[model samples]
Target: MDRGRMELYNLTLPVGEKHHTLAFLGFLAGDGAPAQAIELQARYISRLITGKVAPPTQKAIKHNLETIKNFSIVRKGKFTYKVPLLKLCDLIACEIGVYPWFWRVFLRDPVLAFMVWYGPIFTAQYRLLGPDSDWDRARAACYRAYDVISANGSQRDKVKVKRDDVTVARRRQVLLFTCGISAMFALGYLGKSRNLHGAIAQWY
Candidate 1:
């Protein structure tokens, strides 16, 4: 395959499925509207696919269009988009679950590992709860992380297990407080301890 198709294959479905291409196309279609105008170049899309651009720039959008053109995946004429015959093969490859082999090799990078693991958690925490939110929100963020762990269904199972254990520990503390054990210590021991010697002197 050509470089642009290879890049799209590598970026969206580095693993075993081409679902992300549909996601990309859906993004382009924009809620039943025609695709947005391209404002950026192919290099920008390359940056986006590689994770260099977090939200992707207009330049990146243009780059995606150009890449599709270069790969003959789509033809452009009279300012419109058209799909061709070989493009059907590309779609089929996506549908049948073929991914580039390089992802397995590149998984060794630590930064990529962190992104695959904790990136969504951090992103959600910052967006939904903000960095300065209280511990309750922070803990909820961790719970979101736990959900991601559960959904992925991989060796990351340990992450959810650990979060579950922590949640249980917090629940136990809440139970103790509800039973008045914490309040009892404060009212009984602490209150009496402060006045014990004074009360003894009064008795004398």
Candidate 2:
């Protein structure tokens, strides 16, 4: 799961493909970062669900290839901006507390996911404001904030994503499911989503 995420960024410098995920685990462990703790736990759960296909020694050697071929992640497509874009947007909606994971919602309630992902005004009301919010004014405020962040940060993003290979493709569905858990930490730093404070209390 950790390896797949660094791959998603298409990380090229410092840690090479062979060692980057280990580097990230080092980042988490050296500092006792809460995320790696959670990841390690999730890995244990994964072992429960699928059981190990290979022993620890062979699994360490084969690594991502050994795990990913078992699941539903993109084994066939070249990576694209749309993949990350949708993933991140869907991620925000899930993290903000008013919605479940987009896929679950799409199955149970596509209308809600559509309103959250495809409709910015509706997205704002549920994401930022509670159900009792004054729709027009609250949504207008959220739109303004989005515009500011979008325009301000637009220049800083430089990944030529449309042409990149799908570096972070997961081999296991459980890994993909748990993989995005780390992204919640990032989103917790934004907006009012403060759920990660417990996980990160020591570091902060």
Q: List the residue pairs that clash in candidate 2.
A: 68-171
> Which one is best on TM-score?
2
Q: How many angstroms is residue 189 displaced in model 2 relative to the true structure, after the best TM-score fit?
A: 43
lDDT of 1 at 18: 30
Alpha-carbon TM-score of each model against the true structure: 0.19, 0.22
lDDT agreement with native, every candidate: 0.37, 0.36
Question: Tens digit of lDDT per residue, candidate 2, span 120-150?
Answer: 3333434333222354564455556556755
Best by lDDT: 1
What residue pairs are clashing in model 1?
40-58, 40-59, 41-63, 42-63
lDDT string for model 1 (59-172, tens) is: 554565455555443244422233342332233222222211122312323222233344332322222221223434544555666667666866744544356546856855
- The alpha-carbon lDDT assigned to residue 137 of candidate 1 equals 52
The regions of model 2 sitting more than 4 angstroms off are 1-76, 79-82, 98-136, 141-204
**Candidate 2 accuracy as TM-score:** 0.22
Q: Residue 67 CA error for candidate 2 (Å)?
A: 14
